[model samples]
Target: MITRHLTDISSKGFKVHEISGAVDTLHNHNRRDYYKIVLVTGDMILTYGDQTIEINGTILFFANPRVPHTVVHRSKEKKGYACLFTEAFIAGRERAEILQSSPLFRTDANPVIPVNSEQAAFLGSLYREMLSVHRSDYDYRNQLLRSCVELIIHEALKIQPSPNGLQQKNAATRITHLFMELLERQFPVESTGDPLRLRTAQDFAGALSVHVNYLNRAVKGFTGKPTSVHIAERIAAEAKALLQHSNWSIADIAYGLGFEYPTYFNNYFKRVTGATPKSFRKRKV
Candidate 1:
């Protein structure tokens, strides 16, 4: 499936939808551009990264944009609400950092937690409030919605930690974390002329002040993929986003993505996606 980005949500930067009717149609095993929190109450299976989890009761789950995951509903009836919002929706807020660093949203941390009846009631009420505010005519609805989002996050923080516990941090894990963060920070390319600053594994290693081979080994050891592969995948993802969402010409997109020539970008894109950039854009259209 094509990864869903912030633009796929409302221009207001947030959306809340009931989960039961939509679970079957929701995108599966794809990366998304926004944060997701869902309150599920039924039998379901979730696959996050490399782990698979089964839930049979009330639960609250968080998914970050950087982590790829999917959900499978086993029962015919499900009850819950899911809200999605972009980082920009919460930017400059006091709790933005808390939201970003919370274990519930961390890629390496367990994202699902079982909730008792009272906790489920409280969380469900918050979702209901958010849905109500979303449909209201208030001028400050976005602010109200953000507050509800923060409340949901804070509540999840108080629940029991993921059963998988915390991941032990080692040199390889640390380096890989830094590399992935640095790579993600360059994403969602904002303008046609705004080229990606770091385009290669060597560039990332240089930025991290580590030797190229050391960085590669660390990344590969932790993620089971070469550093170059990660870099190329991220670049390809951004290239697809730009080609689909921006008015920029192919040459401009190439330059913006740090390609010296449009032909190089074309070949690279075809190599990575099995389609030329123009064809990809056409197919998307």
Candidate 2:
């Protein structure tokens, strides 16, 4: 299997690379154990979760471990810098990795930010400086790198679109948010040997310590969709991504997606998308 697990790449806690010609070799980016930030200028399409984002100019892109993303590079001129860091690399003196709550990396927030020439120049300069400082013999290089990461976040915030006025969330809304988080945490199906653990609304309710009925009501009330629909939709999305991007066989993909049999998986796929796995993969190819 082609997987980019954090254990294999977190030896130094972080790495910075100059991106050019094409994107990273790996397409399964849901490493769920580290974070990624990239700044690039290009014309391409970014498949982020169930949404597709178009890229034309310089943009600062923030990617978390929670979601799976694929980039279809369309411009050979695309060149910039990418920084990959483990939580241990950025852990604060007194706090854990608080990026889990950062608006820039949130799953629902915009991960792509278009930058003007001036902003891109400054961010690109930081990446270059980080490259130099990271490979130097300076004793405090790590500290400097962490500070640069912070500066990038602060800079992105300056251009981040302001959210609506804050209002206190009701209990239902809070519960619904928790459900969504829990749901998203078990995604990207990295391994065919490891199937999904939570596949039903009842399972989610058990994990949340709430009655299944209550969970269903809260989710439907907040999102106007049933809990089961959300779970299936996410699963179907991952299935499509795996079929399109991985070389795994259909049976392995079915097993990875928690199907008891290939027939079951085919039926589910057809029901959700009106296409069999074979046809879907063929079309994607």
Give per-residue lDDT, candidate 2, residue 76. 58
- What's model 2's TM-score? 0.59
TM-score of each: 0.61, 0.59
Question: Model 1, residue 242: displacement in angstroms?
Answer: 21
TM value for model 1: 0.61
Which portions of model 1 show Cα errors greater than 4 Å? Answer: 1-8, 21-31, 103-105, 162-166, 169-285
Q: What digit string (tens of lDDT, one per residue) describes model 1 on residues 203-266?
A: 9875554568978887998899999999999999989888888888989899989899999999
| lDDT per residue (tens digit) for residues 137-208 in model 2 | 999998898888887887887877776533213446656876798788878789978998888999887655
The CA lDDT at 252 in model 2 is 95
